[model samples]
Target: MKKLMLGNEAIARGAYEAGVRVATAYPGTPSTEITEFAAQYDEIYAEWSPNEKVALEVAIGASFAGARAMVAMKHVGLNVAADPLFTVSYTGVNAGLVIVVADDPGMHSSQNEQDSRYYARAAQVPMLEPSDSQEALDFVKLAFDLSEEYDTPVLIRLTTRVAHSQSIVALGQRADVPLKEYRKLPEKNVMMPAMARKRHGEVERRMKALAQAANDLWINRIEMGDTSIGIIASGIAYQYAKEALPNASFLKLGMVNPLPRKLVESFARKVEKLYVIEELEPVLEEQIKSWGIAAIGKEIFPVQGELSANMIAERIAGKALDVRPAQDLPPRPPVMCPGCPHRGIYYVMQKLRLHATGDIGCYTLGALPPLKAIDTCVCMGASVGMAHGMEKARGRDFSSKLVAVIGDSTFIHSGITGLIDVVYNQGASTVVILDNSTTGMTGHQDHPGTGRTIKGDLVPPLNLINLIKAIGIRHVRVVDPFELEEVEKVLKEETQREEPSVVIAQRPCALLSKESKIPVSISEDACRLCGVCLRLGCPAIEKKPGGMYINQTLCNGCGLCVKVCKFGALRRAGE
Candidate 1:
């Protein structure tokens, strides 16, 4: 059956048809949907791990037990799983193991545009790049086959466009391969120094064979077109280049690492001018140049952001073609939901005129507009460490004014280590954990604190307050974020304390809660037109020529504006 499928969904379908037994991942943009789609199949045991490291480890364990396994994560998530990634390279695998790392170029939903192809090269593993949804499916199946064939883990890299885009994919029936019998093969599985030394040689020899085989790999193909210019491209860049220069002869590579050197040289010899069309770093261009081949890449094009057909044509064709974004469309900026729980907390912080160190998640939106509560956001779990450093750098007066805010899932993911650092080093800072029940930023996927597994199985949720206390926090308190007075009081009390403290902003994500706050409106009679309520920046609150008004249709009546009102202008519905 042929159907339109997202690249992520197609990968899941491909894995199912290929008889993959286990799949795991921590939710991250451009990669989260892969595991979500995988859970729909009964043949696969799918899970949402606490972090990427654990996710990769789970897949590694499953593969070691002779089941074809897969793990998916965004590019930076691979950094967390790098330890296992390197060791597993030396140890090899019993069954197939494919790790999917989706790179977010253009900083769409990422902190940086660190190319993941480097990870494949660093780990000495074969890597594949898929240009569209169909290749995403086909490449995953091929990745598994290559993993088993080469006795190595395979990396299937995707970018934002390819991961989120949709295309027609021809589905296939399941090929159920029974588990390989497990034997006590210490020489192959163990990573002791002596064993690892021998395995290192095996990895080198395997790469040599794969590089030769890559020459004839079906995914890498040559299309005869204009002989004057030849383009070597892969992943989304190939799609752009094909559209940019339809008549340009092409060498499309799917297996990017352990590059087919002979094929590359052969392609270079065919055309008068050779161009390497790729995004970000010049991995291919540099490699080709090292071989004494004349290839033009980033020098002609850009080394940053998503490559567009217009961009490729403008650079290579030597003229700017008619290309412009839709000018008629209105600009829509990102904003927190009307009843977002993080909204109230940020509003409170703004009222107190305090500094905030922010972590990843929806709460990062607090850094924008009327609230503007956050100061710094580096990466997941960096806020706590940043807050402590601020205190030490500026001394007590400046540091006491700062607080670090992190989500429950993010706190568990990487913030605990920072908290440990605060306690051991005697740093006095207030850390507030927004316990909103689930991973909100990445489509509300279940996390360790949600009391449910990825597959909807009931499990005991991790207690955030108890865990904070266990970390030797003497002053720990849980405050309802909706209660403005309580939130302010707790924030004031915690920031003043001489020791490391924690304030748990206990509230479910407004979207996830069964109850909704009564939507309120502006009372015309009680209006002083002070514009204090405007500071909350709720989308429902608006200022028209007539006067200040609330869009009842959009309001959730969280009453944060009402709490901040000095003249009692804002009132509840039906009041």
Candidate 2:
């Protein structure tokens, strides 16, 4: 049956049908849904690992046990898992292993637009790039076959457009593939210096075999057309190229890393003008050019952001096609949700006029207008380390006044090391961990601190307060972020302390709360039209001609506005 499925979901379906037994990944955009969807299959044991490295290691172990396994993560998450990834390539898997790395070319929900294709080349792994959801599902199954055939792990590279967008995907029944028996082989499984040297040679030999396999792979096909222009493209860029120059001779590549040199040279001879149209870095273009073949790329295409059919059509046609005109989307700036727990903490930080080093999560939205609380946001788990370094350079008093804000999920990802750095280095900077239970920024995926699995299985949640105390932070305190007074008091006292301090602003996410209960509203009679409550800047609260009105539909009843209202206009239901 054909059904509309997201690229990520299609990958999950692909893995399930391919008889995958285990799936693991950390929650990151463009890649989070793959694990979430995999969890729905009873045959697959799906999980949200604490970090990307752990996720990859878990998948690696599963593959070593002779079961088909997969690991998925965003482009940056690849960096965290690179250590295990590079080694796993040396120690080929017993069962088929596939790693999905979703790249965000436009920096959408990401810190940088670093190309992940380089990772495939660096790791010396075969990579498959799918242009749409159907291909996403098909390529994953093919990746597993190729992995087992070549005795190597495979990498499936995806981008934001291909991972998040929806397309019709055909469904298939799951194959009843059983786990093979485990056998300990030191020469094959162990990565000792002597063993690794032999494996490296095997890896090089596998690359040659992979390149030969790519030469006649059905995924890499040539569409015959006008001999004057031949365009080479991969992934979503292939979709754009087809729409742009429909009649041009085409070489659409599926396995991008181990590029088919013989096929590319053969196609180059057939066409008069050879142009490679791709998004971000010219991975295929550079390789094709290196083969002593003249190709036009990058110079006629953009090196940043995403590519669209219109962009390709305009470039190839030398004029704008009769495509839909660009629509002016209203600037819907992201704001803190109504009764958001982080609002009170950010409000206090803004009131005290302190600079905050922020980490990735919903709290990063605090750097936007109205709150304007955060100063620097580098990446996941970087805030604590950056804050510690800044404090060391700026003096204790100045550093104490500064704050580092991180989320519950991020702390588990890599923030623990930074927190230990603060304790060992004796930095007086205060770190505020906003524990909202779930990984809010990435669609409420379960984390180690969430007490649940990707499939909603009950698990023990991590206690942030106890964890901080165990980290040797004597000045550890937990406060309700809705209580502004307590938040301010905690921030002020912690900043004054000479020792390292930790303040956990604990609360459920506003969106999650609303999904379980009827939203609360403002009581106009008790409201004195005071603007103090407005300081929270909730989109649910608005000023009317008569009094301040709260949109019941938007309020989550976290009661952040109630605490801010001096006149007690906001109250609980039936109060």
Candidate 3:
């Protein structure tokens, strides 16, 4: 059967057909949907692990149990799972194991545009790059076969465009491969120094074999056209290159790492001019050049952002296509929703002039004006450690003016270890956990504290307060973020303490709340236009020539603005 599917959905379909028994991942964009789609199949046991490290570990355990297993995550998430990844390369796997990492070349929904192909090289694993949904499906099944055959894990790299784009995929039947028997082979499975030394040599031999086999691999093919210009590309870049230079000879590589050197050399010899087209980093260009092959890449093309057909045409073909430039529009920076619970906490923080070390999540929006509350945002769980570091650097008194802000899901991901460090080291820092009841930034996915699984199965929720107390934080306070006065009160008290403290601002995300919204209104007669309410930065409030008016259409009637206004200017609709 044939059907239209997203590259992510196609990957899930491929896993189901490949007889994958287990799947795991942390919720991250460009990769989240892969596991979510896999969860629908009754044959696969899918889960949302706390973080990429735990997710990879779960998949590893499943693989060791002699079952086909897969794990998916975004490019940056690979960094989190790298610790396990490097060692797992030496141990190999009992059953087939595949890791799908989606790269965001344009930083569309990510903090960085990291190319994941380099990971495959560093881990000495075979990497597959799929161009479209069809290739995505095919490559996954192929990756599993390669993993077991070589006794090593496999990587399938997907870019933002290919991952989100749709294409028709030819479906296949499930393979129904029986689980292999697990044996206590300490020499092969255990990674003691002596055993690791032996496995390291095996990893090197496997790479050599895979490189030789890649020459005959069906996915890596050369399309002969006009021999004037030949472009070597993979993943989405291949799609762009094909559109830009349709008549040019092309060498499309489905297996990117341990590159088919003979195939690349043969193609290079055939064409007069060769260009390596890829996005983000010069990973392909650097390695290919290291082999003393003359190729053009990153010199004429950009190293930053995504590549487009227009760029390829202009640079390689020297033809100006009649593509209209997008008309400049007014900049609409992302802001907190009208009724966002996070807004109240940021307002209180700004009022108190507290320095907030922020972590990843929607609350990072607090760094934007009119709140301007967050001081630094490095990565997930960095806030807790950074806040503690600042206190130790300056003095105990300095901690009184500093705070660390993180979301509930993020806290569970990596912040808990940082919090434990604070207590163990005898440091005084204020940590604020914004319990928004969902992973807000990634389409409201469930987490450990959500009391639900990826399939929305009811489970016992992890108690945040109890966890904090157990972490040695004695002064723990829970406040409704919607209640601005209460939030402010808690912040003032928590920041004044001389020991580690936690304040969990508990509220359901505005989008998740099914409560009726009675949009608030501005009392025109009592309006002073002092711009106090405007400081909240809610999208519902609009500034005009005459005065400030509440855009009722955008307001969710949370009355946060009403509390911020000194005068009786803002109130619920109809008084």
Q: Best TM-score goes to which candidate? A: 3
Q: Estimate the TM-score of every prediction.
A: 0.97, 0.94, 0.98
After TM-score superposition, the amount by which residue 362's alpha carbon in candidate 3 deviates from its true location, in angstroms, is 1.2
lDDT tens string, model 3, 184-217?
Answer: 8899889999999999999999999999999999
> Which 10 consecutive residues of model 2 have the lowest summed lDDT?
513-522
The 10-residue segment of model 1 with minimum total lDDT is 318-327
Residue 437, candidate 3: C-alpha displacement in angstroms? 1.0
Q: What is the lDDT of residue 548 in candidate 2?
A: 87
Per-residue lDDT of model 2, residues 95-131, tens digit only: 9999999999988889899899999999999999999
Q: What is candidate 1's lDDT per residue for 46-155, written digit by digit as tens?
A: 99988999999999999999999999999999999999999999988989999999999998888899999999999999999999999999999999999999999999
Q: Candidate 1: deviation at residue 342, Å?
A: 0.8
**Alpha carbon deviation, residue 290, candidate 3 (Å):** 1.9
Candidate with best lDDT: 3
State candidate 2's TM-score: 0.94
The positional error of residue 217 in candidate 3, measured at the CA in angstroms, is: 0.7
Which residue runs of candidate 3 sit more than 4 Å off their true CA positions? 322-328
